[model samples]
Target chain A: MNMLEVTNLSISFGGLKAVNEFNLTIKKGQLYGLIGPNGAGKTTVFNLLTGVYKADTGTIVLDGQDLVKLSTIEINKAGIARTFQNIRLFKELTVIDNVKVGLHNGTPYSTFDGIFRLPKYFKAEKEITEKAMELLKVMGLEAEANFTAANLPYGKQRKLEIARALATSPKLLLLDEPAAGMNPNETAELMNTIRFVRDNFDMTILLIEHDMKLVSGICEEVTVLNFGTELTHGITADVLNDERVIKAYLGD
Target chain B: MKKLSKSTKNSLINYGMVIALYVVIMIIQLCGGLSNSMKGFLVPVCIYVIMAVSLNLVVGILGELSLGHAGFMCIGAYSGAIFSKLTEDTITVAPIRFTIAIIIGAVFAALFGALIGIPVLRLKGDYLAIVTLAFGEIIKNLVNVINFGVDSNGLHFSLKSAMDMGLAEDGKIIIKGAQGISGTPQDSNFTVGIILVLITLFVVQNLVNSRDGRAIMAIRDNRIAAESVGINITKYKLMVFTISAALAGAAGVLYSHNFSTLTSAGDKFNYNASIMILVYVVLGGIGNIRGSVIAAVILYILPEKLRFLSDYRMLVYAVVLIVVMLFNWSPKAKEFKEMVSYKIKGMFAKKEETQA
Candidate 1:
């Protein structure tokens, strides 16, 4: 069964259609890429799917759950987690605490349990700490778990954002410009990390990227967007070689 | 027995310091080292500590500037005072009555916290601050126009004049406009104040270490990221705000019960009072709970202790404030403080290892 399906997704800001009639379908465990030039509304698609933006017209079904009317937090709980175009870590928090924030929903303790430090609070807190540490270890950030996030290097900060997202245990992960500020080496490393995440977690991913190399490297399928509309979509190689895709990137 | 974790050990040390300060004060009191005036300030010091610590939950942990904390304090003080007055004859036990009054005050303040938080929490930064300031002013003004009395006929209320209350001839006026509540039972003592401070610390510290607390700090650090992580922003925001306000209300109960006469005046429960609490939180370090406690105690007593300085007392107090601010914010001072704390922690760890 398809993990996610969007039909006729549309949004407009002051008569300019930021995203219009956008449709997408991804089977379980598929690694897909949404590539577009500036102003193509790639991020807008992610925002709409994640409930950050209210769609003018559309239906977003994730694993048979309608995500349109839900809030951002509800959509996230419904199994869609995303990273940002800009790295957004809880800068003052320790790296592990940043991951713990993602694990918040999974814990079953209440505010009273927390205030009183009930047995469940301890049990759940210990489990969360273990899980958060495991995520940090997965991202090779175990050594830096106690460090404040803003103190980390740029590349590591990006990696931490992904780790934080993965900690949410989403059925589908959305990456918006995950490699925006990375050098070639960091991008290459992120490509491997992304592949590792998919293989180990058996999770589906939808990535938005302006970097052609990074997108074509790991994506099994690619969707090209132009002026908030889908231009073409196919296997990675075919879409990259399409004449329209080239013109859209280079500007006709 | 299992060895204590580093974080747990650190927190134990923090609590130890608070208890140690209490012990020292007790010893000083026994030895008659404190003047009667200083003894009078003791309960108020504990009250202020509770206020500062509770406010930190909002200003520091939740990362929302609340200038209307005094408003919650006012709600708590008046509600608690009135509850005690109405129950004065019924609840013969002093401690029981005081407990019920504190709970009533906290609940009432928490309700107001939820009411104000729902609308203002949607706005961020300076806007939140200004709206909360307005809330404080509104509450203060509302109290001034409020006139109420309680008697065998139950409760009577009026917004205009006390004469308009239309109560029985023997109806006792509980609140008389700007004059506020008078003849409130002074049932609170240093011990009760200390217990309340410890309770506030326990609740706040435990929350800070729990999953909910982490979520609160996450929202403060980055609201968008917190939302994307499946955190209910409204739920957590309201939870923290209500809890913080409730604790402030508890402090208000302690304050009101310590005095026979209580008024919602500019000097007592007004905008400046709110700012004073915020100053304690900031000077203590925004998210530092222990710092808030220490800052409140020291700052509250500093001016009184410097009374011997007389004419130059406030001048010295102003100088001391500047130095503390610099120490907190300056890079070199921060490094020095970190080094000192690191060394202290290292010493404790070594001692534990040797004992093991």
Candidate 2:
């Protein structure tokens, strides 16, 4: 069964269609890539899918649940988690605490349990901490778990964002420009981490990337967007070699 | 045995200050070192501490600037004071009546908090602050026009006049317009105030340290990221705001019961009062619970202590505030503060080991 099916997804701002009639489908455990020019509404598509932007028309079905009209948080609970292009970490919090915030939805303790420090609170908190620590370790961020998130080096901060997203345990993860700031060495490492996450978590992953090298490295299937519409989509090599995608990237 | 975690150590230090302050106050009372005026200020200081700590939950943790905390206090004060008054002749026991009154006040304030928060919390930053400020003004004006009375039949309330309340000849007036509630039972004392502060600390501290608190802070740090992480933003925001308002209401109960007469005007429970409470949170260092307590106490007491400066009293107080703000927030000072706190933590660890 398809893990996600977005059909005729459309949104506009002041008569300009920011994302028009966008459609996508990904099978379970597929590594998908979304590549577009700067103004092609790639981020807007992510926004619509995650409920940040209300669609004018269309449906986002993830694992058979309709995501339209749901709030961002509801969509998240419905198993869609995403990272940002700008790297939004809880900067003042410790790295582990940032991950723990992602683990919050899965914890079963009520507010009363938290305020009273009930046995349930401890049990859930311990499990969350252990899980958060494990994610940090997987990202090679165990040594920096206690450090304030903003204090980390730039590359580690990117890795931390992915680790934090994974802590949400989403059925489908959306990563936005995960390698935007990294060097070649760091980008190679992130590519490995991305594949490792898909295989280990057994989750479908979709990513938006500006780097052709990074997208071609791991994306099994790729979609190209230009001017708020899909230009082409096929296997990675075919999509990259498409005449329309070349024109969209080169302008005019 | 495992060593203490950073959070555990931090909380120990926080509560330790509370206990130490309580001990010092008890010692001073026993030794009769405080003058009459200083003694009079003790309960008010405790009340301010509770208000500041509670306000910090919204201003610091939730990252929403609220300017109508005093409005919640007003709701709490009037409700609590009236409850205590109605039960005065019937209950005959002070502590039980006061306890019930505090709960009533907190519940009413919490209800209003949820009501107002639903609409106002949708706005953010300066807009949120302005709406809350308007709410505070509206509350103050509403209280000014209110006329309430209690009779053998039941309670009566009217906005027009006391005559419109339709009370019996022997009925007692509970609220009389701008004069506010009078003849309220003065059942609250310094000890009781301290106990309530401990309760406030327990609730606020536990909430801050818990997983829920992490979610709230995450929302504060980055709203989009928090939403994408499956956190119910409205739910958490309402929870913190209501809890904060409830605690402010409890503080209002303490404030109301400390005196036989309570008024809601100007310095009492007005806009300035709300801003003053926010000042306590900001000046204390946002998100620093222990700092809020200490700042509220010292700032509340400073004006009284600076009376020796006479005409220049407020000027000196202003200077002190500026100096403290810079010292607390300036980058260089922040580094110095971290170093000093690190040293203090080391000392505390050694002290703990010796005791163990």
Candidate 3:
């Protein structure tokens, strides 16, 4: 069953349509990719999906709940989480603290408990720290837990963002260009890490990427978009070989 | 935040020595024949320290510029002052009224913070600043129009009649006008003020270390990324802003009671006070709690302490503030750290060469 269903999603900036009639169905625990050239409205789709920008006309159903009416935090509470295209780690905060932010959405303690450092606060904080550390360890970022985020290397920063998103405990995770600036070796490692995160966390993954190689290597299914329109969709192998996707990507 | 380097630890220990020296100054104030009136100024200075530090949480930690701080403070002060005044006549209701007033003030400030935050926080950068500044003005003007006094007939005193009663002078009584409210009961003491300072410190510290606190900071660093990560940036930001405002409101209650006067909510709530607090945070180091506290104390006290300089006192103050900001004298300042480390290295190098 599809965990997220988007039909005829479109958004516009004044007279210009940024994303038009985009549709995708993501099932639970399925690893999927959305690939297209620049201005294919890839990031715009992510924004529209996350409720950062309301779809001008579309229906977004996540876990059987209509997402169009929810606020950003409400969307998160509804079990959808994502990461940015550019690295957006809290630079002044420690790595563990960054992950703890993700865990905060679901923290069960009250503000009163936190302020008074009551038993619940202590229990909650300890649990959060342990959970954050576990996620960081899974991402191979445990050693840098105490360090400020800006001090981490580029690959580690990307991992930190994923670890943070995972801390939110979402059923479906959206990654926006996770491997954008990485070298080949780093990209391969990221691909492995993404798969590992998927299996270990048991999460449905949807990512937007320009790297056709990474897209084809890890994604079980693929969707292609061009000029804000859906160009094609199917299994990664078959969809990637389609002529429309080729022309949209290569422009022969 | 790391284990302070050995030398830095030693330097911190030296800071303890500086505190000891300051203790001697306090001793001199007590023993060197300074009048009690001269000591009265210390109360406001302490209150300002609390106010500025709490305000810094919003301005620095959450990284939002808030001009509505004084408005929150005004809310606390009025709520507290009214509680104390109304209940003081009945011994049975007085303490409870007073207690409830403070708690009520905090709640009011939080509600106001959320109310104001919804619309104002949607604005980003300088637009946020401008909206907050306007909110402060609106609050101040609202207070100006409000008349909270009851006449001899036991009816509420309107602004026009209250102004005509003139200044009610009984020893240290100090306010009188639609311009300001005076004759407020002076019931705050050092114990209450200090206890409040400690409370504010505790609440702020806990909030900053909590999950919600980090979420707020995450939103602050990058809204899109924070949202992408399911942080619910707006909720967290509003939460922190409300908490910060409530704390400032509590500080205001303490200030109102300490002075036995209210600065006509309209008269004193302005952008200047907000900017002064902002300067304290920046001069100290944004997001540095101890830095903001220390900066607040210095900024508030140094001005009065230098009062003997007469007119030059303010000149000296301006000069000192300029020097601190320009020279980077605060502890967390990069330049200040460099200068101290450079001197420390110089000292250590001499010792090493001499031992060699």
Candidate 4:
């Protein structure tokens, strides 16, 4: 069953077609990959799906709810959460606090209750802290829960982003270049972590990547985007082996 | 009871510090060590401390520079003073009357905060600062021309002069244009100011540690990432901005009530006053609530106390200001302080081992 379905997604900036005629479908438990050369609009597609940019024409259906008209915050409320290409953790906040911020919408308490420390404040905050700790433990960051987000090592910061996104309890998780600045060992560990999240959390993740090894190693199915359009989509092996994809990444 | 979180411990320390300060001041007063001038500085110091901490919310946590903070204070001052002037006879009880005045002022200020924040919060960086600066001036000037009167008939308002309001003989002018409001019961004292200070501290410090505070600080740290994680940017920003404004208004109520005559005619609520409050936040170290409290107290009392060295008073004051700013903010100073603290802790550990 499809968890997220995007049809005819297109957006433009100053007459430049950043993303054009984009279409994607991800099954409920499948780990999907979005790959393209530099400037081929992979991030733009993420922005479109996440409502960072309003689509000029398209429908984004996630779990049977249309999200084209929703704002970025509302889109996340509809069970879609995203991480940035460049790590966007709340740098000043502690590791666990970053996750608690993600748990914000999930746990509801009025600002009044918080300021005055009403009975509800203690209950809600206790619930939120416990939940955030669990997510941190899942990401193997429970030990560093009190460390500042920026103080964590590079690979661990990326993991923190994943942990934070998970705190929101989204149905579809979007990862943008999760292994961009990591060593080979970290990349290997990240591949295992991604698979583990999929199995444990029952998450359907869509990611954009330039590392073909990471893409081919973990992705069940791949969609290749070239020049703001879908060049090919199929099983990972077949799509990565396509001659046109190689040419698009390399030369004419 | 369960173990406390690190943040909760820090908050407890801050509250303890405020209580300690209160006890020390009260002790000094009881011993009759406080001078006439020192006692005079007491309530104003509390007022400025409240102002500094409230402004810190915008400049530090909210990550927005607001130059028009004094405008909200002006609103609170006038509204509170006017209320007190109108209800002096009906509500003869001072504490109850003052509490109601504060609530009225805070609410009145919060409403204006929402009004100005809608347009002002939309701007960024220097534009936000410029607009807020303009707003501060506008509010001060606006209050200067307002003539408000209350009579047996009803409340009366005029932009021109008190005579234009056509109030009856029994009616009293609450605010007489440039004269402002006079003869309002002086319900604020050093003790009441300290209580308000504690209340402000409780509200601000607790808000900073709460879940909503995390969302607010998240927006400050990274606006885009916050939104991506499902945090509503505008809602949190406006909410914080309004709260900060309301707190400033509360401070204004304390300020106006302490004085027999309350007026915005001079530089009390001017651009300079706004900038002075900002200086307290900055010198105290932005985002440090405890530091704001200390900075407000010291900076306010330093100049007044330095009257003995009249010739070089401001010069010495300037040096102290720079020293405090550097000590609180400079990286080298921070490292040195941390190293010294570590050394002290290590000494205690060695002594404990020796005792064992």
DockQ of each: 0.87, 0.85, 0.63, 0.89
Q: After superposition, how far is residue B40 of candidate 4 from its true place, in Å?
A: 0.3
After superposition on all CA atoms, what RMSD does each candidate show versus the true structure?
2.3, 2.4, 5.0, 1.3
Taking the tens digit of each residue's C-alpha lDDT, what string does model 2 give over A1-252? Answer: 899999999999998999888999999999999999998999999999999999999999999999898999889888998999999999999999999999988888998999888899989988988999999988999999999999999999988998888888899999999999889999999999999999999989999999889999999999899889988899999889988888889966
What is the C-alpha local distance difference test score of candidate 4? 0.91
Chain A TM per prediction: 0.98, 0.98, 0.98, 0.98
Off by over 4 Å in 4: none
For this target, which candidate reaches the highest DockQ against the unseen true structure? 4
| Deviation of model 1 at B161, angstroms | 2.9
Judge candidate 4 at residue A214 and give its lDDT: 98
For residues B112-221, could you state the per-residue lDDT of candidate 2 as single tens digits? 99999898778899999999999988988898889999998888999989889989988999999888899998988988888889889889988988988999999999
Task: Give candidate 1 misplaced runs (Cα > 4 Å).
Answer: B339-356
- lDDT by residue (B105-188, candidate 1, tens digit) is 999999999998898888888999999999989988898889989867889999998889998988999899988889999999
Pitting candidate 1 against candidate 4, the one with the higher lDDT is 4
* Candidate 2, superposed: residue stretches over 4 Å from native: B338-356
Candidate 1 docking classification: high
Candidate 3 predicts chain B with a TM-score of 0.78
Q: Point out the worst 10-residue segment of candidate 1 chain A by lDDT.
A: A113-122
Query: Candidate 3, which segments miss by more than 4 Å at Cα?
Result: B1-38, B92-101, B104-111, B141-146, B151-154, B163-176, B260-268, B327-356
As a whole number from 0 to 100, the lDDT of residue B27 in candidate 2 is 97
